[model samples]
Target: MQLQAYTFADTTEIKDLVTRTFSDSEGVDEGKLIGNLAFELLTETPEKDVFCFIAKENNAIIGCIIFSRLIFVRDIQVFILAPVAIATEFQRQGIGQKLIRFGLQTLKLNGIELALTYGDPNYYCKVGFQPISEQHIPAPLKLTYPHGWLAQSLTNNPIPKINEKPKCVRALAKPEYW
Candidate 1:
């Protein structure tokens, strides 16, 4: 399988993969929520520094991951990776891992200093993520694991001190509701 920047043609396959994967997981029964999440990633503003990667095999998308800018008080460049998913049949094939590594490399080349993800620490730690703590970076929310609020700095720069929730201009919901 090859991991590449996602394209329009891969949208449907990505959607199908997400649906198949989430159907078995509890509390994720909302189809429109799934669709909106994908839209939020795909339509991310370049000025906001959001990008994505898709895993493909036999010309079909099997997995997807997203990285988006998280604006803090200091203009620090931090990215949040969310909703990494693999097609049910392709689980355990490392497609999701590949997508993440690829995206990380892509972001690092562009001088991004940090990457954050709301995912399993066990899974993400393999790629260098650790729990966000008061000593390093403050929690994005008061929330904690198995919710997977993890962070890793890709550079030597210290994680910025965040006194409050980062301002989020985009709603994760649909445009009509905004």
Candidate 2:
């Protein structure tokens, strides 16, 4: 499979992929929830605030991931990974991890200081994520799974402490996602 940045023309297909993939794994309700989230992230977020990557085979998208800016009171450059999806058949093949690594590398090149994600610690830990506490970097919304709040510094410096909570994009502003 090939990893690359997503294009505008691929928006609908990407949304569908995320929806179908999540639905198959997490049930219909979750599939629709994440699908809508993906749609909003692609269509509503500012270009500068989001980065989307896809994994494809034979020109067909098989996996997708999104990273959106997490704005803080300070001028720190941080982004959050969320709502990743791999086609049901593509899971366990490492496509998700590869796509995430690609996205993180791209973020580092673009000068991102840190990356955060809320997800399965076991899976995310494979890609260098570590469990972080709210005291270290406050989340925009109260986290239901505080242990899943993870982060990694792209720079040599360690993850810094932020006095104020960060703000996510409108699509991820809801509490249910946090």
Q: Judging by TM-score against the true structure, name the best candidate.
A: 2
> How many clashes show up in model 1?
0
Error of 2 at 132 (Å): 0.5
lDDT tens per residue, model 1, 81-164: 866778778988777777888999889888898888766788998887877754455544444353466788888765555665
Residues 26-93 of candidate 2: C-alpha lDDT, one tens digit per residue: 89999989999999999999999999999999999999999999998778899999879999997898
Candidate 1 — which residues are off by over 4 angstroms? 27-32, 44-47, 134-136, 139-147, 158-160, 173-178
lDDT of each: 0.70, 0.93
In terms of lDDT, model 1 sits at 0.70
Candidate 2, position 13, lDDT: 96
So what's the TM-score on candidate 1? Answer: 0.81
